[model samples]
Target chain A: MDIFNGIASGFEVVFQPNNLLYCLIGVVIGMLIGVLPGLGTVATISVLLPITFGLPPETAIIMIAGIFYGAQYGGTITSVLLRLPGEASAVVTTFDGYQMARRGRAGAALGIAAIGSFIGGTLAIVGLSLLAPVVAAFALDFGPPEYAVLALAGILLVSSFGSGSAWKCIVSATIGLLMASVGRDLFTGVDRFTLDSPQLADGIDFAALVMGLFGLGEVLYDLERRIKGNSAPTPKVKNAWITGTDWVQSRMAIARGTLIGFILGVLPGGGATLSSMVSYAAEKRAAKDPSRFGKGAIEGVAGPESANNAAATSSFIPLLTLGIPANATMAIIYGALLLQGIAPGPQLISEHPDVFWGVIDSMWIGNILLLIMSIPLVRLFIKILQVRASIMAPITVMIILIGAYSVRNSIFDLWIVIAFGLLGFLMKKFGFEPGPLVLAFVLGNLLETSFRQSLQLLDGSLFGFFARPISGTLLVLMIAVPFLVMAVRLFLRKRVAQTDLQKEYENA
Target chain B: MGVPTRRSQDTATQSEEVGVVEADVDDEAVTPAGAWSHLVAGGVPLAFGVVMMLGSINLGLGSPTSPQPGLWPFALSVLLIALSIGLLVGRGRFGPCESFGSGTLTVIAGVGSIAAFTILLPLIGFEIPAIVLAAFWLKILGQESWRVVAMVPILCTAAFHLLFVEGLGVAIPHLFSF
Candidate 1:
């Protein structure tokens, strides 16, 4: 009865006339961001963050969360239709999705992806509902050092998730960590790298950095390929509906992917990428013909798509229950919470059960709403994509400028966005991935505070980082994992080279 | 185990070629226009972080009880520098201009317009400056139609003003007409 009471209360809060409108607006913007090739959910959330400065904390957060998940639904559309992933998690889906499109199964592929996402999302909501309170209770005991270690561990783990060349990942992560240091020293008050520019006194805005890196950077990269006159051939989309056989084949993959994704998502620092990769591998291993995986197998598309959505849903457990964000995107959401004055630790559930439960409850409503909106609009979105970037570019630039200016009504911030946009374009050209940079920027403030607090608590002895069990264990793992990955990569490389040599010898 | 193997196999044929092509692409992406000036494009955050770091010197940015003021900015600056270095080096290693023509113009145009808009925004208020900025940017970027140029700035300015100011109660600073 009380649970029912709680649900009713949640509905009352979320379905408020204004809140409902905000939720609808949030999803629409989220879908637009996800459908666009360069923009992602993080950028959209950050850009809109300042606008939420006046709303109720709960309403603002619910709407933002709605945007985050809504984008997940829209991300698949681009990956399937254009072979261009709007979000990182959708990268894997593109493999099978584009293939299926090529084979005239775009409808079936789109159908399964949508249905699977809904199922996974609904399941994750149920899981979160059951687990949040218990997890929150446990997280109450954590302190500053624990938080510091958690953030550090997240950065390390995320770096490892980068594709290709562990060294590149390491270097990229290190650069991110270093870029995090660009502003005033939180400990000493000494400017380390500002070089006398008055504009940098506040340090880098995570919003501007992400907007530049992802949005501007991608534009530059795309321009390069486009100017070469290699226009993307618009594939003729076939019946975008799911058939009975398609459903029968995809049911198992979706189920398995959802389960796998939710579990992996519970871990820190790995969400869409980890879940999709794991699901892809699982689907391939279980497939009758594994080769079909890269060639448009329904299982391939369904499993990874389901896994990505499920993982995106489950990533909330750590945030809601433990007050921890395992990656950059979640870190931004955490920032949103902080702005709302809603501290997300162990006490959140009992202290603010309505907020927690309402948000959780809203996820279901939001997903269902997204399903209703997205299915009918899939074709419309596909048509929207056909609007040449050249045409859309101007509109986007206007939106970015207006969005930037509206935040704090500050011209300074708009200028900042513009400057960062250029930086982003350049960075993309240079092969530096912006993901780690944005992640670093988000973690920058926390890492500094946490490190300094730990130092202060331990009287400046570095040993304190290792003295705490949780911190110590995590640090050791962070140190060990990199070396292990490096060694393994080297060993494999050596082995491969030896095999090639042996083959040459045999030919001789 | 298989992931790495499969990845390597996928890239095996093209890894070396990819490296070479990537270097050429990098150069194309950043040529006479794309060079270190591109680094200045990042000057906002770099400068912002520096100013914040400097302010912490005396402001007691972080308290001794929790965290000192200088702690966050210092860390942020270091991260910014490392990232910048990585970007610079990564670009340098790759080179430019084998494929795309003077792509750095996009970077320059984007950064220039944004900076110019910021300077003009406070002077003219939201609508005129925003419209001019948007129209100028659109025209420069190749959208020539008056409708394409005119509609975006006017509509966006109104939409933003309504959403942020009227609807949301966000304070919007208008230079001239309310």
Candidate 2:
């Protein structure tokens, strides 16, 4: 009854004119960011963070969340038509989607993907509605020790499950922690790394840091491999629709994908990209004829598409309930929420129920919007791919500088953006992911706070962390899961198209 | 823990972009020079960690129970030093390390002009710097034609002035109020 009441209230919030309009704008922008290769959701959101400062907290979160999920739909457009995946999650779709397109079933491939994404996203939102409160309820009992372990687990999960080097992820995390350690200490009221700069006393601007790293850094990196001036040959994608046979064939795949995506997405570091890969493998294994995959199989497109959307939706569980972001993009959202002065924790459901339920319910609306807009917008999305990076690069850089400056009306913020931009560029060149660094930085203050608190509670023995039931269990599992996963991976040496998946993430 | 090395297969996998922006990440990312990049990457962090660690020590790290201002940072600095050392001793590409290519000059140029824009903005107003930076990028970085380079930057800067200043009232220091 409470859940239904909550849902009804959520609907009322979402159905408001301004809220609906913001949601619409959010998805459209999300679709644009998704269709464009290289300028990822993280970077786009980073640049937009400053702009969101003016909006109401729920609307800001709703719009940002729409961009996050709308991207799932937008990415599939390029994969089916041009054999180029606009986002990492869409990489697996290219394996079969392009083939399907080559066979003149581009419409069908896209049609099924849209339907699958809609079904998967909607189901995951429903699951999130049901499950997030339970998880939040369970986590409400968590103490400082539990929070410390959970934060550690969150960072570790991001580093381990994320693509590229785990060592680098750790290194990236340390740098982020270092960055977070800047500004005056909240506990003792002493400057740590402000270097006597009055601007840094408040800490490096979050908007500036992210814009430099993800936005400017990405642009500078792209200079090495600049976008071609030539426009793409017009893709001939007519209005796509799924046939009854196509639906029958892919229905089970979508169902299975929904389950896989939901489960993986709820776990730390298990995001849309990971779920899509797992779902593809699951579909391949469950297939009556395995050879049908990677050769224009509708199931290939269906399973991964569904799974990724589901995962994207379900990944919200950890962040909303526990205040632990599951991935880089989630970290940015977590920061956005923090900047809005709304701490994301177990108390979020009670303290900010409208924000909590509003975000959850908005996904339902965003998903429906994506389904309705997918076929109509495919041509426009493809046309956007032709916009040369040269034209957009400087404009984007200008936007970043302005966005950073806009944050606090400080010129120093502009310097911060460029400085971090250089660092971001160098980071990418070195294979150190900026994702973990940003995640760590955003969470750094909380981690340090909980850590100090936990230690005091433990009487500084530190081993007392392992004495508590919940924190101790979590710590043990965090330590054990890597080895368990490694053993499983080694036992099952039958590697799926996992390298290709990693390749896409690296691209992203 | 078995640490990761930049394997030869990773080089193969670096071919991420296929159609338009084909990632030109060749052996350049993992060359003999790349090894030095590894040193720079590791050494910079290590040095920062040691300095910060010393600073934290000076800040008076209390015992774990009675923590001081520097305690948390001290822990982080120590962790940083440890990770940096691992990065140094670890063989092969520790992560996605790239050798600065020819385009790095383009970045340098772009950043340099932007820096000029920042420095000159408050002193000489945002308009001139914005126009200059935009023009430099369009003409030099983008290699646009004389006509485009001539027209776009002025138009773009005027557009920015209108949007941020006149339209939005952002309070960016500008030359003319109107």
Candidate 2 chain A minimal-lDDT segment of 10 residues: A226-235
Clashes of each: 53, 7
- Top candidate on TM-score is 2
Q: Write the per-residue lDDT of candidate 2 for residues B1-178, one digit (tens) a residue.
A: 0001221122123223223333333111233345788888788889988998998898889989999888888988999899889888884456646667677799889889889988997898787877778778867887655655566567667777777788777877889877
Every candidate's DockQ is: 0.16, 0.29
Models 1 onward score TM values of 0.78, 0.93
* Model 1 C-alpha lDDT per residue in residues B39-141, reported as the tens digit of each score: 5434433554465556545444454445554545455555555544554455434223122355446546655666776676666666676677667755665
Clashing pairs in model 2?
A429-B97, A429-B98, A430-B96, A430-B97, A430-B98, A431-B96, A431-B97
Most accurate candidate by lDDT: 2
Q: What DockQ was computed for model 2?
A: 0.29
Q: List native contact recovery per candidate, as a fraction of 1.
A: 0.26, 0.53
Candidate 1: tens digits of C-alpha lDDT, residues A192-220: 55657755655655555555555555554
Off by over 4 Å in 2: A484-493, B1-33, B145-155
* Alpha-carbon deviation at A240 in model 2, angstroms: 2.0
Predicted structure 1, TM vs. truth: 0.78
